[model samples]
Target chain A: MKKYGSLIGQLVIGALIGFFGMLAVLDGDFRIDLSPYAYPGNLIILAAAAVLAVFSAYRYVSIRNLAKQDLSGEEEDAAEGRMYRHYADASLASTLAILFSLASMSLSLLTTQPLWLLIFGLVLIAFSFIISGILPGLMKNMYPERDLPSITDKKYAEKLLNVSDDGEKHIMLGGLYKTHITMNSLLLGAIVLLLFYSIASDSSQLFSIFIIVGILAITNTQYQFSIRNK
Target chain B: MKTRLKELRARLGINQTELAKRAKISRQTVSLIERGEFMPSLLIATKIARVFKEPVEEIFQFEEEELK
Candidate 1:
């Protein structure tokens, strides 16, 4: 969610992840048998990817607009939901990445060399995203809402809470919520896989441990900083 | 955390929606501040005080932390 990123940015991220997955194929990082891409049924996968890309773009625009607007009561709630939807859109990228990566793994499985290395690489992709996403929730507690730099702006700070003041940072909370949720979901899945891998080796446990620690810390913070706290 | 914001708004004859419009913040923010669902930032606290023509401390007292 950098200021300059848009649908194109997301696509770029997707392509890069996909490219690494392709590397997963060539290097035998993991292995799975893939249905050939030329098959008519595989066209569905391509179409799904296209749809995910479009949805991600729409959500990106909607949440970004929320961040910019200064709306009122009901409108603010609506905007929050829209921002959440935007984060939800990114899951499609994740889903596709999982599917395609698996396809590559399956293709590798057909060869003589086992693709154990690719599994490790896919695990890395999942680990990075989850940790990044969970970072905010834990950090949010450390960073209280009372001193946001935005609140210091003359336009937002000195003025009364006018509709216009809500403009720049209006729907930010919602957007943040979405970002965390999408990240958490992806991380959760990753952690589960890591759990399975744990029976074989200790390395897989590291990421899941971080995830659990992060979740507990964030939950504690959420309750501690809840608005209802006395 | 419940506030006298409603009373202040009524005294000024400003509807919540109108006050929200004037404040450049959402009505939910106003409501939340009043109900104590979310603490306002210092700037927002000041803004509320400004709307009521009062000091920020008067409008938003910190809750006394309970002794453990």
Candidate 2:
């Protein structure tokens, strides 16, 4: 799935932004001083968070609708390919949703202002609900369980069995399998590092990083599971 | 590079969907194969050949330029 390049790119960008936010918080120097009493900027940040939430909801619907179109009566292999393509697209959208939430959280960390922090926290909360709850549920519906092949359908089974094990297929499958394992391991390691850092820092701000990293871990795990199962 | 898939399927009185289902592939792939837009891998070609009880050479042929 080189088709997933864009999704991976978005994820990398989000990670970079989160990294910079961590640096800003670590510096402990407040740059761009605003009136401590000024609630106007806080209100604007909150409004922006609200707008993101609405946009996320709209985008979620749009992604689902686009995926649904892939299910039109088509050849089984092409349909399967379409299903995979949909997964990639939906995942990209989900990553964006997570990024928006993380953006809010990172903003909170940078400002260290209680109101801005709270608003960003709420943004993360809303997106967590969407990404974890709604999107997975929709995916489950899109890819329902299928019955295992029986021995009685031997002819069709025989045909289906070795159709994907040719040389090129093997190379492609091996490459994807290796990529998934490597990425999953790296993401799991990152989550562990985040956990250790949060403990060492004794800071709640780092918890946001921990949460976003945890979310990424879940996404990676789910993708690997889907690839193996499908 | 070229295939007699459409002609053969017509002779068998079958549609693209039926051929795809029997071959355990997508109709889109079958259509692409017929239109010479996509070449089937060996495994798929074998499966399709089995469906027709024919040899792969009979179903698919490479043009002179393609052989080059």
Candidate number of the best DockQ = 2
What is the C-alpha DockQ of each candidate? Answer: 0.09, 0.22
Judge candidate 2 at residue A174 and give its lDDT: 68
Interface RMSD, per-candidate values to 1 decimal: 8.1, 6.2
Question: lDDT score, residue A194, model 1?
Answer: 61
Expressed as tens digits, the lDDT of each residue in B1-59 for candidate 2 is 87888788878877765776688765556766776666788979999999999999988
Alpha-carbon RMSD of each model:
16.5, 11.2
lDDT winner: 2
- Against the native chain B, what TM-score does each candidate's chain B reach? 0.79, 0.92
Over the stretch A1-230, how does candidate 2's per-residue lDDT look in tens digits? 77699889988997897677677556654433344633555556455555655555665566566445633233443554555455555555555545555655655666656674666657556664665445544543333332223333546445434443343244456667898778767766676466545544554446656676777768777887987998
What value of lDDT does candidate 1 attain over all alpha carbons?
0.54
Per-residue alpha-carbon lDDT of model 1 for B1-68, expressed as tens digits?
54778778778877655666566565557766766676777777777787778987777765667222
Position B21, candidate 2: lDDT: 66
The local lDDT score (0 to 100) that residue B41 gets in candidate 1 is 75
- Model 1 residue runs over 4 Å out of place are A1-47, A52-230, B10-21, B24-32, B61-68
Q: Please, what is the TM-score per model?
A: 0.35, 0.42
